[model samples]
Target: MEEYQKLSLIDPQRVANLPTPDKLFLFLSCTGSIEYPGTERAVRIVGEKLGIEFIESVDQTCCTGYMLTCNAVNPQLALASTSRNLSIPQEMGLDVGVFCNGCYGYLRELAHLLHSNPAFKEVGDKANQALGREKFHGHTKIYHVQELWFRQLEKLTSLVKRPLTGLKIAAHYGCHYLANKDVAIDDAQYPTFHEEIYKALGATPVVYKERRACCGYSVGRGFTHREETVLPHITNKMLSAATAGVQLMTTTCPGCNTALDREQKTITARGNAVSIPVIDLSQLIAFALGAPVEQLGFKANTTPVLPVLERFIK
Candidate 1:
């Protein structure tokens, strides 16, 4: 690549003189809806509160990462799907923002693969060409809404009507998000941004031993190793949270929320009867921004967020 060409591709500000994406092209994962509906509402409410625009496309499809991880589809198929989905917003000049760690990591990795390997690029290119759409040149960037919220923390702080007073909350940064630690906004081993986010919303952020631990279900690992690995892993993680006096746990990924929340109800059967409600970070922000309780869709949680509602939702 020529010097100017290389600079244009890497520089967000210089490339095409493109204005930084202000309107988030929100990408909701399957888990975001079927498992945790609050993520959708939370993103909308949080976007409204932050004065940031959010746009959704029906043409957008699942990131297909979960299927790839589960061995349902080969990496080639996943790459093709990503190329097509990413090409949609790339043509519209919008950056993609995902509410699931799986999608963010999955797409980012695929995009990286396409850029680094001519072989993968050819596969994606052929797929895009066959579909008769713009070629997927890996032109678009992917982000998590957590990063967006962190960027607009002050504005988020200003909108908090119901301060989460004395609500001891713990942050679960999923394995995929932490995978890119060197490029992360905070230390991956001990990130304080989520805790800072808690203070911004007037809540106490708890620190625990398993704060950075995996949920044991990444990429269908739970299905393969649930009995031997997943259960014991979650049990220990939850025990640490309960020990730290954490009342609620917040997740940026809906998949993480599903594992953490659903697993809480069965901790007792495993010999320790401890439970803490797990919710999406977006829902917490929405509640703080004064979105109606019904809009949060907390009913999707099996662990029951009622205690949280009873405490804060007056």
Candidate 2:
């Protein structure tokens, strides 16, 4: 076995060997679908430009990892949900590519747990048995869409119809994406892969103090701790980005996109006067690759992205 594949024996779902996937079972996020459909559109657009086929299955349901993380759902049910969703891709002989960090992290973590631990394997077996379909064999590999983009960096660079020259962009890796350190592409403490991607698009990537900070909306924290925690936490993060002169912030997760994009208005309302537009990394890639602004769905964002769009896209 190759060194990377050997290292991934413990967690096969997070194999380090980056394959050029021509077709992928695109794992859809409920939050991304409802709140920011544009990100999904951007993913499709980018995929098209890259000549990759993304398969969306209606049979694939929510990963339920969100509710599981929120402590609102039973553990077995969450495992079962993950098993069912993963089975769809596995049955189709395609690896899973997720756009949201929540889906990416949860699916990988849960799948790893189900396969590695005999106790959880029992749970997965039972869950599959109950459904009366193919048992969860843990064959499907889970990957974040960003990894795929990084894998195709050369092709992506070639497809950049609108280079993001002189635009200052910052990256928010999101907590969930970094949570699985063993499977991540770069160091958790100091990642620069996204910055490298920005450079590929001819944009100046800014590294701010709080670029790696949690978006404060995970696991229902936005609702439970808005005033006491979420607001102040987000406020500080945005201020740090503003201090770094970030024109646009890109997130790997739609949940982080929602938190960072929506909370800016809240921060501004409270007199902080910080308004940095946030968008999905895929959406930004789509924009740079000549996808139309209307197709990107910037209108749904609370913080207007017109200034950033007008500055670079025109």
Judge candidate 2 at residue 211 and give its lDDT.
73
Question: Which residue pairs in candidate 1 have backbone atoms (N, alpha carbon, C) closer than 3 angstroms, thus clashing?
Answer: none
TM-score, per-candidate, Cα-based: 0.89, 0.91
lDDT of 2 by residue, 199-261 (tens): 899998887878778888863454464466788889899999888888999999888888888
- Candidate 1 lDDT, 1-314, residue by residue in tens: 00101111122222224223468687768888777877887888888777768788888888878667755546888887888888888878888888888888888888888878999888888988998988887868787878778777777898898999889888898877767654456556656677778888998878887888887666334455455556778889999888888899999887788778887666778788887999889898888878899989988888888787577887
**Best candidate per lDDT, number?**
2
lDDT of 1: 0.78
User: How much lDDT does each candidate structure score?
Assistant: 0.78, 0.83
